[model samples]
Target chain A: MSDAETTIPRPSLGRLFWVFLVMGATSLGGGVVAYLRTGLVVRQRWLDDVTFVELLSISQTLPGLNATNMSILVGDRLRGGMGALVATLGMCLPGASLMIAAGFLYGAGGDGPWSKAFLHGIAAGAVGLILVVLVQLGAKTLKTFADYVFVVVTAVAVAFFKVPVPYALIAAGIVAIWWHRPRDKDVR
Target chain B: MKQLWDLAGVFAYLSLLTIGGGMAAFPEMKELTVDTYHWVTFPELLHFYSLGQLAPGPNMMMVASIGVTVAHIPGALVALVAFFLPTGLLTFFVGRLWTHLATWRWRPAIQTGLGSVAVGLVLAGAIIMGRGAITQVFFGVIALAVFLLLWRTKINPAYPIVASGLIGMALHYFNIA
Candidate 1:
């Protein structure tokens, strides 16, 4: 039989949910993408490397969290709409539950001096983390001098002028896309 | 009833702003959730965001905290569903059409353009958040140190963040902060 004809059957919806649940529960420190590649591409063979990358690019390009986007894309590819539903729920449930519990805990004790101090410290540390993420993303995505210029302009627009994020996003996005518009000389 | 509707509307709106990642939505999230609706304080928003970084799934699951703060478990469910659904449907339909558009000449342009802007938005978010997060000299030092460490080292981020929190507690005990 051809590789197409003898392909592994689609995983059951329950198994899809179970696998995503395990991934969602175990993917620590915000590296869900790596865990996802390992689980879906390497271990389970639900998708090949090329398809995984394609889905990932889609996830990144769209406006959503990568983990949930990946879950929706991958699950849909595997078992249609119901698969997408289950996968997204599985991915979100563990973390959402914890955060809800955290809300209750903070409501109760967040005003205590020690809790206040701790939360403040973590906030500062999270700033560092966000900065790191910004730098890494910049390194990967930015190419041209104009691209760097767009980044700075957009940042200043929001951070200094208080231009709303949606406005900045649209304004910068339009300019950047027009600048990079199909260059005939550099045609791929 | 109206509160839940408001929660749903706010998150759904914030959801679209998350182009690059959850951080891309931070500024608007702060504007609507903290400033507009008063569902949580700035410090509380920061706290939930920080806690979310340590959580196991999608980083933006912190929205659940805001929901719970507003209306308990049902609120949390509403927020999550609202935040995810609109973008989720977009991705589903777009992902299907993406393959046919692979050969479209403008695809690369759109990708590269959006990529840079997304980075900028995340930078903008960090700046806005920094105003609140980096209040004191010690806090600034902690942020700088964590930045350098994460930039240079392969260590997991949780260790340093948790350590920073413990140090904060100690500093407060000693009347430093």
Candidate 2:
């Protein structure tokens, strides 16, 4: 209900696990934000929008899929260790199982035209989905020209300059860390 | 055993960087699986990339192709599970922390940046992956269309993806691009 209690209102492990299971099968794009917003915020009303944004941010920083991180965060909120495990499994197992099957199919040559057709179709569609998600997120996240500029320059750097991703990441990370250093100090 | 462990290590590293989605890891993924390890050839990566793009879930699922290419069945299992684990755990912790300090120093900025970076990474990935398939005009158009249509339209958009493959196959059938 009201997550207003200061004593760290934990969600029920069982309920979160159930949600985790459902989300595993459905969540796509690796964004996991939509699933969290829909499942936890809108459908279940487990978290408000403010909470969702906060949780989403935390999920991004940690070293994993945003959805997986979300499962854990939600799980821990609800039921600590069990919640974490179930949530992880929920996000991990479905994709892993699918991958294993894909591995088998792929190993078997994936020879059929239908299979090839299916793959080609889906790949193109996925990019479309990616573009949609990108625009949607840009609306939500990048509010300024500078942010858009970063997006443009980053895309150009990778496309035109043939910048290796690791170097790009390292450069971005340094810029981010340094850029934020002043603001971080201000907040502290 | 060493190979399985190697698989584990690769997934772990990839998982860490893969922040927004599976595609985010592609550039690194291409470098590691194709360029560095030669687990698969570049053309093979394009095939896998194309498939991953088409599939419904995470494009990172393309990592499965690497597993299949490596030690077959077992390699796929190892990579899929291992790559996901660290991130799963990390997400759980971060997810919990979301209730507290998401608006705090650096968190908000980092997240905003990640959202943008994820998109950039996907585009970069497409460019890197498309170069391999771009020798022919038809393929080039398909690639460009895929990018443009994705950027421009919201009309469900699945149609182009399905149609493109038929175009490719028909091209092959007719001795075309």
Candidate 3:
């Protein structure tokens, strides 16, 4: 319901696809969100910062990859159903093709000691990358002492006790939601 | 054929568990793909995952790698569609409904509540992956170094990650690790 939504011109489906395709092909490393913000808000000028953040919040609240979810939401906003389709396809195509090719290559030459050593090192580096993501996510999402407790309980249950993720997600999710339930006094 | 079906079912199921991000589904993905299906060994899973990080788009696109391993191109196709389609549809419909739910009372609660749990899931994933990836002290140092560099700087992550690989190669040449 922002002015940008009404003011911005709707892009053609092809344009949408092309724009997202470029983002998919160039958003190197793991931080697709920053690249997305640059492409959509800064470069394309299709959405303002507020709208972008709002859509990003929705993307985060939902259960999908942020990059693809953002693509669908933004694409839907710009050009409706076909826009969503093309955007998701464009965003996924580059990585998908590369990974498929990687699969073939790995199958052919993966067992070599050199390849194994390199993969091992990168895997360790990836663990570092994931830790950074976790710390950043925790800072943004976690607030109260109880919230930290929820994080620990969930982590221990899953990683240590080997509790299935679904069970842990459901049990922790319900409790956390109820604890944060809107109180009548705090109506905003 | 059966392998294709298995790939579809497993990835489709796995997709729903990725609430916060792809990492949230890592442990379960490990369970099904490595322990149960034997499609790829643990080291191979870690390799694909790290390489996926280097890939340009979604980090979890490596799911296709597993599928390709199991059943070639067909497996990849099935895994991609299955992994994406259900969640894509859910997102499309829910995104439309989001505007209507803007003022709903429980909206804030749902957002905040899920946010914490999602963080926990990602943490769990990191721990599980660390167990597999940080086998040696040298690798541990690499992980910590990358963590500090990324935590403090604005540099592109790809650079440090590639350097880590090169360091590994160097170590191998010198028979250090």
The model with the greatest DockQ is: 3
lDDT of each residue in B20-82, candidate 1, tens digit only = 899999989988999999999898899999999888899998999999899998999899989
Best by TM-score: 3
Q: Global lDDT of each model?
A: 0.91, 0.65, 0.94
lDDT of 2: 0.65
Indicate the residue-level lDDT of B31 in model 3.
Answer: 96
Sorting all predicted structures by DockQ, with the top scorer first, yields 3, 1, 2
Q: In DockQ, how does model 1 score against the reference complex?
A: 0.86
Model 3 chain A: weakest 10-residue lDDT segment is A1-10
Q: Is the docking of candidate 2 incorrect, acceptable, medium or high quality?
A: acceptable
Candidate 2 residue lDDT tens string, B1-177:
788888889878888777555666777787788777888777666667666544433446667768877888788878877777777766655455555673467665665666666657666765665566565666656656765875675443445766777777776667663
Give residue B167's error in model 3 in angstroms.
1.0
Model 2 error, position B176 (Å): 2.6
Please identify which of the two predictions, 1 or 3, would achieve the higher DockQ against the true structure. Answer: 3
Listed in order, the DockQ scores are 0.86, 0.42, 0.88
Candidate 3 accuracy as lDDT: 0.94
**Which of the CAPRI classes, incorrect, acceptable, medium or high, describes model 3?**
high
